[model samples]
Target: MPATPGAFLGGVVVSCAVVGAFEAGARPGGSAWPARARRTELCRARQRAGSGSAEPCNPFIEENELTDVGLGGLMKPLKRLLSALTGPIPVTRSRAIGVSERLSAVTTLTASLEYLNQRKQTQPGGLNHWPTARGVHGRSTPVTRKLLDIISEEKTTLTLHAARAVVSAGMLLPGSSRWRGAGNIFLGATTAALHPRHRYGTDGSDQVSILVQTATGLARFSARPQTQDALMWYVALQANASYFVSGWVKLMGKAWKDATALGGVMRTKTYGHQPIYELTQKYPRVAKYLTHGVLALECFFPVVYLAGGRLARPMIASAATFHLANGLVMGLGRFVTAFTSMHPMVAYTSAPRTHPSVAGRDDRVLQVGAVLLAGAASVAGVVAVQRRMRALEGWPHSRWLTTRHGNQLQYEMSEGDDESLPVLVFVTGLVSTSEHFGWITEKVARDSGYGVVTYARAGYAGSRRRSASSYHLAESVDDLVDLVRGVVPEGRTVVLVGHSLGGELARRAAVALGERLHSIIYLDSSHPGELNRSHQQSEATERIADGMNTLVRSLNVGLGILMAQPDWLEELPANCRTRVFAQYTDARFWAAGRREWAAVEEEFRAFDGKLPVVDSHALVISAQQTIDRDPEQLLMHNEIAEAHRGQGHSVEKVVLEGADHDSLLTGARFATEVGRRIIEFLDQAESHATSRVCVVEEVGQ
Candidate 1:
């Protein structure tokens, strides 16, 4: 509605009159409030709380504190005017502008002094919190979550009664009742919430302890007023630290030194068109120095406060004033948010989830910052802690094997429903780790009474990478042979199990070991016929050469970078070997890993050498499901298994029906079935060995 002429004129006249009165009274000392009043009040507040009296249990202040301290950001501005005239403001400027702190502070002090003074006269030394007739109780911007809710839902008219809330700024002034009680209560609650670990844990933090300690001291001291001043000064220091830092960081930047550049940056996304930005533009040099100076003060103030003695109170009082000025000049939400963020002890009451600005900011920025902070700190902290615990429990580095390439290798061991026993040692496929086979490994251990061991090859998992020339089936066999010799050498033969590429490695290792091997289990290992059949070795060699070329590119410029752009390149892990790191870490290394297997398969099929004879019990556990739409791929698994089984070895075929290949080793289905078979095999093997030993003993007899 348009303003009525008479009414509008009346408002202008009143505004002029009010401003004149405020300006006059605010001239540093219309009455020049005695600093002693502040000190006396502090002492009285303690006395009022009878000696050993329990802390206040009022609910009004507790809930109101949240809004007052600043979390309810959107309501701050509307509340500011109310604070000025009614004295609801925090002590000092925050309270100085509001009638609240001054009113409370005075009432608390007067009541306490009267009680304590009377107690001294009557019985002396102690009159804990003076039983007072009780009572007590206690932002930011409009663009908050609260504002959005209001706008979207068409809530009440905000402009109507906003002015009615104003309180006297002077009420928070020294010698006022509000400042004594309200500020003290605020000081008490906030101190309780602060982190004890923070350096200045005592500054404003130990309010309860300070109060308790000060009570007896007050009675003894001739000047209790000075002590109160000191305490206020300390609390204020912690509250205003951010103003110094924000101004400092920005001012130190090169652009801030140059007026034009500083203005440009201010106009950039950093500050937008806020009043502070405008102020910055008008006084670049002054702003820069002031910002830099304040930051330096904030950075070091905590240290000074912690140093004890005369440094604490004075420094804190200065900081509080700086913050108050910042609050008055800038809007509430920013001040409230900033204050809470820096020193968490100062909780501000804010309108619930509302924006500080009119329309709110870009949601994308909020989401991104949230992710960045949470991921870098909270999420990472949890993950690192979990890993540490697992490591502490003796889960070794061998759990996740690294591939020749930088990437990790995980393979699920094969499990099939065969009640025979076997001591299964699982070898994972290329670029796979035993972690994937947790199900199958557990099954072998539990149901089969079988012991399973899986590990990464040399090049994978940050292990040293070997050259292409160094990675043939023989090299793979050698590694397995070494493991067997070292870890389980006494076991004449362990049921060796391999899946896919792992199977090929297992077979080669078995053949290399000769009579030392017991039985071999191949889980749909790669077949020679799946790849180029005609030109075998020569063609296979060429494929290796091409892979080496890709590996060269990866090694030269970090593999992930070879495939993508430079800036986007991930920092190669320091522990990774160059050769394997280049290829496997590329993420495209998978294709190369598969290609390497195919080449090996080609070489195996075209071999003219005679096959090794195995007299041990063999099990061919096949995955019954198809993962990809490949014609020859599905047939190779069966064809290879049939060929091995037909070689006159005591072979058992068990296809885990309707299961994915990855889960074959780790899933419950594989574990329950595969474990039972392996256990039986081990029992039979042990029985046979015992029988042979007995026969030898009989011969000796």
Candidate 2:
């Protein structure tokens, strides 16, 4: 008979499986036949009819039988492998039907009850007004506001319906196979729907636990009587895969491997129990051992399962005990129930099967192919979604302007029609994007009625990189001058506002601008003397910067999801906070920040003893509550103020009490005060300029 398509595929799959097994089993060793012959000779000698021998061996036993010495050892492993590849899969017979049904009922009831309790405590007032209740209202953009509200509603409704369906179906008709299938289907759908909302939840890992349970439930429902064991085995394999992946990922992190992460987590008030926290603190070595033990168990879970029988039972018990301990220590009661529900199924599936062949090898080949295809599709889907999200969030759409050096700079401008008002030109500190001044810029533009502009320097944010030779202070000043001249209206006077290292660039630009400058305001700005003093970069600082750059680039996506808005930004709309956070996680932002740190010493030294002879008014706003505030820094500010006065230019100094350097720009009270001070200075400067023009005209007449 000619071979069919199914047979051909089966032949190909079996060939691949055999080759893979051989590759895995091959190792450097003596001849297999010689080792078997030696073992057989020893066994035969021991089995010989000796005068005082207590143990007996049957003459009918073959030489190969001697190799299977330890508790069904080598032969059992070989049989299990053959079974997995081509033998009949174990099924739940009539006697085993009630076991799965009972387990499913208990899991459904426990999950439903716990979910209801969680909803009462965490969600409050159900789905109605949930977005506003969760403090998600009044977003800066309407689209984001609507999207957040919709997602919240969908998640709440899906979870509620799915939990209710599973509970009702499992409890009312536990014996009914159709109802069991219905419950599993609903639970699986719910798990799929909740995947995207995991990050939004307080316990993301809890959601993952529930997802595993859902998979086990679905596997039980869809599997046929004969193939059910195979499906269950696959689910157990998934559980082991999860543990191994999580354990290995943690091992990659230094803190987790060193046990510090375990200690830190235990000490947290929200997630930690009092007993565990106290115990970990009192006995640090215990914490270290516990951490290492968890890593070992999780990483070796699959090995234990493969060993089967007595070896597997202890490890399985340990996993259950570990979950129970977590429940007690971290108040993760749901995880205990959710994960424990799957344990019995995993245990049952992991046991050695004894059954004759019922299905052809072609079925096994198709099953393996389907699993591989599904896994590949899942990975591709995740990559596609991530790329789509990045595109939708405007990460790729950079606002560009050609600089004097032909480099494109990214920038943002606040819309305003008030040409009469002085144009507020903002320069951000090193490594920061134009969006760093988001809240302050919006407030200033609205309150002061000034056209505001902020731009990312070359190689920062979304801007194109500059030539290596153009990274110095002079090149930066030239870029700033061109940006302001091109963006600002021709007749409008410019008010320069510089924050941190931006102050250095502002001072340099002010000198180059000469008469076009209306006034300069420094908000907790860096002084020339401070820069010259700290010109030589310390190795420690350099190491810290390098670490930050690496971390930001590698974990940018995760950082974007988990970042909380600063306390100062609490009053801004939620969408504004989201936008600011997205910019913070941009790889270009970190790269540019590192460059700024690298060039700062040289840039500062280049401008040593060269202070701009400012004919325009100057205002210095200093933060009083800076943690690293030096006495010399205060003296530098004072000296700069005195020098402006000495030059016969109007100088004003405003000290903000209880405000840190960042808070000076973002804090609600401080930002409002800063805005008021800037308005007052601009008004006075405008008045003086008007008077001087009138006097000059009168003298000429």
Candidate 3:
């Protein structure tokens, strides 16, 4: 890269032009993309958003519209549900009936395993530190207690993360905000707690001390917006761009017609099996409308964002939602951060490069060119972070980073709720974590009286991650088995929700807990049957594999830079350790991703099997809108969900009337509606079962 003696000025010029051009495009009079390409992508994005341009959804609907049922109105529903929970847990009773047949002379290993766990009070020193984590982590230290409280301050992770966005307006200068001083306070405090000498613990005390310190530090830091805040808008831009581009490209192709790609995405082993087909079966006429609407949202979110003004707000809001859903379903990064990073907020948060009360500071800008350059640089940094975070999630520098299941697993959980309601243990898929499901979990708990537990399997975010190796499905499965047993406990009525790779795990969880689980939900899930047709042999496989390599490697270089900039790392105490370890230790996950990217680039790898052969009953939530040129793939999503519904085991599918695949999670109506439905399903299932039990006992007695 050649340096421009005064390249800053030149960049400003280009930025000005781009902004102007973009603004012009926002107007109805502006030159539209060759309608063929423009319309195709736009439609696809809309479908992905699940909005068929229908009476443009009333995003202003009150929250009460969805959850405010009068006590009298709710009593009937509650009575019906109580019957369900008391009913002999179907599989449990059956299994219990045959317990004698299964209770052979207890094997020595089984006895030992039982003895070691001892109801989670003690454990083997090295095998699984779950018991230890429970003792050490469950009971937060004073410091940890503080951080946990701070995290608790956030009702949902999305808001917490969104609050971190430091998109200083490009027009303002830095240091203008006293918040920079606040940044100083937080950064100074954390530097000592996270100092490498102390943090890279060589002994057990190091582990205990670091955990305590980190917990306290995070509480202190999270109390501010630093952790979730980190100018998250930077990352949001890249992630949203990826989302919109992916959605639009797919929609622009012939795939848009059938909703095959969108649907298949839900059914891929990567996403798990979405009950898209079930929704189609429930609302055959309206399903496609939902599919196309979602596609269009995905297609043009980028454009809406770049265009700025009123039009951009909805797209931005929806994109934010999309990201939150991604967190919930697939277990990706923070949604609010990912969504705001690239959208209109960039201009305002970045312009003047000044924020009224945000932390962190750099030089102020005078010229528009300088502002654009700064924005551009910031934007680039965001992109760089996105590329690197994947690697960061799989690092081994931290002990929790190495927890592996089937290959890899990510977990997400609701806020402090074990005491609040019955537990709903959610098993997430690849590249997912508790943060993803933050919003959904909150919605479910709020709308329905239930608690949820989700987490990063390992090698994801700051939870447990992979060691030096990449994740594998089998390993991830084992992790799931262990995590569920340890965290959720057995014989509890758990409502399991899985998405993408998580769906498969959800199935596994259902299999493991059978009677313990009251219901299973697949949110745009992946089906094992949808394995890429050629597997390792396909070109798409090669492309995806290759890109992942470059992405992570580049990220490592960025992490290396962070390591060198002790000040910068210190300033980022909330995520410093996470970022550093992810960059340094988990080189392989990114490497594998690179390899996959190289094989297939970003193109979806079609799977032949499409879905796992299973007989378990579950609820599937799918996106049915289409906004693509090639429509078949998007259409297939609904069809597949429908086919599965026919397999018995009560499957209920609902179409997000104005949503697309990507936007549904973020869409105002979808989040409230879908989340509400999930809550209802759990309640009904729990209630219906309990009541059935009462009648039988009464009759027998």
Candidate 4:
């Protein structure tokens, strides 16, 4: 009977898994035979040393002896146990030969077409601007530079064109001589080797696909059956090694262990795709689980391939799914086709083979039990560590209010006995937690004797993740509304204070609040037009956020211990400072901040050229230091103020001298003055409202 493609894929997956499991379970030098051989060598050396020769004892053997009693005896049974589990099954040479030709042809042809498509999509000009090419131009010898340029340009063009022609010819004439395919394969491989850097100009995956196609072509053209088998095995081993090593290397990183690295990658233009990026933003736990899943699958890929039979099929299916998802979400078009081409080699190599050992059926059961035990222990350890960390770092003075959608929103409030005083709500800027307003929140509450509110947005510190369906701006506004209404007493108006992107949200809230809105105070607030003008600036911010998240996750403990208390934090109480530092070092805080920044553009567009219409006076406080540093930003601030003034609302514009954007809130020299000005504005607004009420009452009488 002829073998199906599905069966071939299954065989490949099983082979990979078995090989991986074998590698994990049986370390090369740890087996009894190898250990005994080492011991024998050591005894000879000791005898030589006694006869006046100088030789050092094996450190590994010494360490093993110290760690375990009768190390060789203990490992012997375990080694035997693994061998029984991994014992090969019977497969005929006829079956192996039957699949090899078909599988190789399919893999080669698919890879070739994919490579051609990649070249078309990423035009030749793109290769010229790659970092590797630029480096070559700067550092390479004149002759080397010319050779590289020729290889990058002429060779790439000729190889791609030739490969495309061969694929097209093969499709039209399936029985064409193998010599033609071999020639095309040689041309492609030579081109890639000449300037390996150029192959990855647009996507690294393309290089893998091109190389696989060349290898397959060579194997198919080879007259010797042994040579063909060797070539197939080589491709299969390389693929398995790539997955295993990639997974192992990622495991070494603290970012991957904590599952925060994916979030950082998603924030970059190169790797971030909106669908998957937003999915991770909405459900960070999903990203965490996905990180673990990818690592496990890659690490165990060799085991799946080695397992053969039904096991290989599921592994192959899973690998396909992974590549497909990555291709669509990350725009890595070449990965889907490139990696899939290697599947044939995996299938061919994984076919069942007869072994002389008569492994008992009971040994299979023992192998299953051993695998389950190991898997269980790994899961339990991971859970225990995560739970311990979470328990150790509990939130302080945390209060949660359930929104209409049943999501919990966290906020901190300070109130005075005065009911007539307007409630002051402070909204923070992009990537900022409520702790950012600690000093300002304290100063305002202390001096004014009025109620003040500071709350974290969704996915931020102490706040639960928002509903998946909720848009960033609407969700933010809804959460703010809930927090205010839940906390503030009835019949009292509220003042909205916003900083940076928070200021933009305040403007949107002002429009929504209508009669309930008291006034708005903008502190170095983001202008509506700013988003349109700051593409490069936004990219830089994303990069900074990525770096911060990585640093925080990788050194959470070290940073917590080493971080010095900033001068601005001194204004906060001791307990508050500790809480602030804790939040600063958290991966969640950084991830939430990145999501907030990512949504800035969409949030800015939600206004549709409409300004907030508030009956109360509006205050615009621009930092003079920021103005001097960026004249364009100052002009934007001025334009925003003038636009408000033109709208017939009572708008006041003030520039705080010697204060930069952040210094307006944090600097000791300017914070007091900034607070005073804010209080004065609030008091004046209240006075004006009272006078208007008195005049209206007199007219009515």
Best by TM-score: 2
Residue lDDT tens for model 1, 219-282: 1232343343333333333344444444444443444334344345346552244666788767
Give the residue spans of candidate 3 off by over 4 A: 1-422, 427-433, 464-471, 531-543, 559-616, 626-648, 666-669, 690-701
TM-score sort, best first: 2, 4, 3, 1
Poorest 10 consecutive residues of model 1 by lDDT?
692-701
As for lDDT, the candidate ahead, 3 or 4, is 4
lDDT on C-alpha atoms for all candidate structures: 0.41, 0.57, 0.42, 0.60
The window of 10 residues in a row where model 3 has the poorest summed lDDT is 692-701
TM-score of 2: 0.51
Candidate with the greatest lDDT versus the true structure: 4
lDDT of 3 by residue, 1-701 (tens): 11122322332333334333333323232112122234455556666889755653332232224445786467646744543222111111111111111111011112222222332222245322233333434545788645534442313322322322221121112222334333323322333322221112122212222222222223234434333223233333444456676674554344465754445455656544367545555675575675676787877655543321224344544654664454344433222221222343232222222222222422232244457867776765664566456544443332231233323444444434444345666665443334445456658766665766765555444443434554345455666666666566444566667765576667655556655655567676654443343243333443444344444554544433332332222322243344444433344445443332332222234334445433444567665552142244334444434443422245565544555553444344455666777776555545553222110000000
* TM-score quality measure for candidate 1: 0.33
* Residue 105 shift from truth in candidate 1, angstroms: 64
- Over 4 Å off, model 2: 1-108, 111-176, 185-254, 295-318, 342-425, 429-432, 435-459, 462-686, 689-701
TM-scores, all models, native as reference: 0.33, 0.51, 0.36, 0.44
